[model samples]
Target: MLTRQEITILQELAKQYAEIASLPIQKEKRNMWLKLNTIQMERPMVLIDQIPWHEMDVDGFLKTKVSDPHWRGIEWEMRTAIYRWHHMPADLVVNPYICLPRIAENVGWNLPFHAESEVGQYGGQAQTHIFVNQLQEMEDIEKIQPRKIIVHKEREAEMLLEAKEVFGGIIDYRWGGFSSHLGFWDFISLWMGVTNCYIELMDRPEFMHAIMERMTQIHLEEIRQMNELQLYDINTNICHCSQTFLPDLPKEGDIAVSGNAWAFGLAQLFTSVSPAITDEFEVAYMKRIFPYYGAIYYGCCDRLDDRLDIIAKLPKIRKISCSPWSIPEPFAEKMPDYCAMSVKPNPAFLAGESMDEDSIRKEIRRAIAAAKNYNRSVEFILKDITTVRNDPQRLWRWQEIAMEEVQR
Candidate 1:
């Protein structure tokens, strides 16, 4: 139940959101994104997501006044959207709708682990952790099982009804689903420690294949159930922290399936693995599921410069992440022109004691030059931002610089 003050605050934010959504720039940006995604260049786009909100305290701009935990989340989202537009709008499309996700309970894949991390100022962000490996031997592979997704349709309807009652006329509300981040090896590293997994990959090659095979089947079943239930949210504006306003998704008034959306896959843990090794383990399994989506966004923090050829083999490969660790020139030269290069600039530049404005500008320019030299479509995605030394203005300034450079 929302209090009167909470309702008032949300209502005001919704009105502001509606106003922003109604802007002419929103449609223009949407068209630009569609062009970029389809390999028809319209100029590069820039987006800043995966921000460290805990470190941002700009005159209490991110603080929430709402009391309830659930409503507080909604309030925080509304505030963040409005705040983002004011600071680093950067090709973002402010939608006129709020999404209510279906209530789901996932069972199976009962992998156990014990992990420890230091609690500090930026505890909410990523930190160094010590994990206990749960999978010890090849025989332990039997423990993994296909997950069962149970959606509570009645409860989902009730939540949607409540949201409609709150902001029905002020803003539209729709049912949204989770975007796929299907990385089997990434999960395996958590279950079986990174060192152990790598050793097994070299020594017990058969065991590694068995594990990959099982993980692939588990994910396929999970996605199939989600598709059958029509729980996949393909109507989203963002997919894996990049613009998803392409012309080929979320079929109108039809049940949403994996085929109607963009699916994200990566092997961040396999960063040190050779191209052939990655092909056998990561790419082979991921390819099984890649065909299920309308398009695929592959790679993450991993440096994929060597495996561009291997990654190119996947079906519907639309975009590939070019992490900060990757050399822009080589990747740009080799990447398929059909795929958009999702360049992830280093967030460390913002985390320094003082902002390195010159380096930041140079880095963005380097990416731009590389993409232009190869005639590849590109988008600057500033993400995995762990911190800004508690200075929100650092990120704001970076966004300003990114937008200026991309436009030029």
Candidate 2:
């Protein structure tokens, strides 16, 4: 419930959002993203992101001089979206819909150790550390159960009606989260501490296999459950490794299944593991899971220079992530013609005492030169930016360099 003043402010923001979403340029940019994702010829795309907003140097980024905390939070998100559209180089859509979920909630059995991270003094960028090994023994795997999803039918309908009354003409209302981006190995690493999980892979191979087998089934069941509930919104276009639109979607009906949308997974915890171990544990299970998806976007922050071959072999793998540590030349060479190369440039370029324009240009040039070979599809996703050194302008400059390369 918003006060009259707050409602007025919100509706004004909604109008601004509507204006942007209705732009002719929006449609053109969208088509470009769709073509790039579908492995067609187009200029390289760019997606700039800063994971933790507190780490950014943008003054008053979050703070709004409002008495009501709820309205302030809403203002924060709306303002951030507006700021990103104006500043960042990403192909962001001004979706006027305030999307709400139709499904209830899924709560998993609690693991003993929680996911934790430590933020630095400069900016609130966290150094994550997981300290749990719930699956130390084979017998512990029995405790795993499929999450029960509860649908809030009355509440969902009430909210949708209220949204229609308040922002019906200005912004649309819709239900989202029909599809999912699930990762089996990523969850396993969290349940079992990363180090212990790695050691157990070598020590207790059978046990790891059993856990993966159960985990895969659990996810498959969960996905089917969404379909059974009829909460899926198939009309919404989602952005995964690529910007997916109506044209890129499968010809299937509106059902909540992996084959309906993009599925992304990453095992950054397995970054240092040997290829053999990787193949036995990670690759084998991923093959089982990825088959359910219409398209796949594999790897995140993890350097896939070593495991690119195995990942490239997966069914419907559309985008392969090239993290900061991955050498672009080899990644470009190995990236399948059918798939797009998604590059995650190092964010460290902006974290130093000052912006290193020369170094940044050189690195961008290298990536451009490598991917330009054979005109392979490429998208530069600037992510993992932990710090901006109290200067958000560095990000804008970096985008300038990247967009320049695209034109060249």
Candidate 3:
């Protein structure tokens, strides 16, 4: 149930959304295309840690003095690394917040509180408990049940309003994963540990599926609530989702992540796994859960180029992962239209190369030159990025490159 305040705000916002969403679908498509271009071309992403998720001294952020008035000049910092994504040639993921599930652990599952980067830095179990030997014992797993007042409600609401106020709508407070990004796999690896769950899959197949399906339902409900509230329609650039495997499609009726649509992550993950393994256990599953997100990337944060032909069949996918090792040209040629490219650079370049201006310049140039012929507009994401201690200047290259190209 929405609060009177929420209803009032949303009713007003709904009028704006109707105007926005009513723009010709082609125009919206063009807008997204332009946005994708902005990602690949213009505005260097300045990954601002606009929202510090480490149990923010929320009061401090809310009350702190802001002397700088310009949007570009607005002063802010984060507990963890945040790139100025607009200037950098990459996707802008609002830091620390992207890893929401881990953060929420700080507030307990039932409360509406979010997990802070402090909590994420520590991380947590995919499935909280391990070795629950009894069937009924499994029932007590962590979940944020519906129909209850969420905790941290005040913090979250306050943060949202503050961001909107200061940023003048530039700060996009996206509601990302509150549960597992991986469908059934979230519970298996989280609770049982990957190794333990793998063995159980073969040793106790039916039990494993039941547990995975159950966990998936809990997770789906979480996403469903977010979707119902129009939370998914926030200023988010893309409805981004990823996982390890994919499932095969089925002929007839099957319950999907949403009402009738299967989840895309499952389909992509299946394509990544070896054919023999998929044929035995995952083919049927992927076939059913292959239609949710508009854009999907699969496989080990690596270039899923090998899986492209299979993935291309996904009508809604608009972005595909391009790993450092993946051959860019062929994959670029192969990705069916509308699928933007997500390029995963070798993190070694960021850490290994000497942090001289020339070296950083060359690295950015080489990446841009290499990605010149990509299937769609490019997205350079640095996964496992940990350091920038002495290389603050390095972040500027991506944004500079995109700005230079877009103008040309």
Tell me the alpha-carbon RMSD of every candidate.
Answer: 1.7, 3.0, 10.9
Better of 1 and 3 by lDDT: 1
Worst 10 residues of 3 by lDDT: 95-104
Give a tens-digit lDDT track for model 2, residues 260-354: 76768777877788867777777787787778777777778888887777777678787888888899998888778888888887888888899
Query: Model 1, 274-357: lDDT tens per residue?
Result: 999988888788778899888888888999998899989888888999999999999999998799999999999998789999
The list of candidate 2 runs beyond 4 A from truth reads 55-77, 96-98, 115-123, 128-130, 231-242, 250-257
> What's the candidate order when arranged by decreasing lDDT?
1, 2, 3
- TM-score per model over all chains: 0.96, 0.89, 0.52
Off by over 4 Å in 3: 1-187, 197-208, 238-272, 275-300, 313-315, 356-375, 397-408
TM-score of 3: 0.52
How high a TM-score does candidate 2 get? 0.89
lDDT for position 84 in model 3: 34
Best by lDDT: 1
Which of the numbered candidates is closest to the native, going by highest TM-score?
1
**Global lDDT scores for all candidate models:** 0.84, 0.71, 0.40
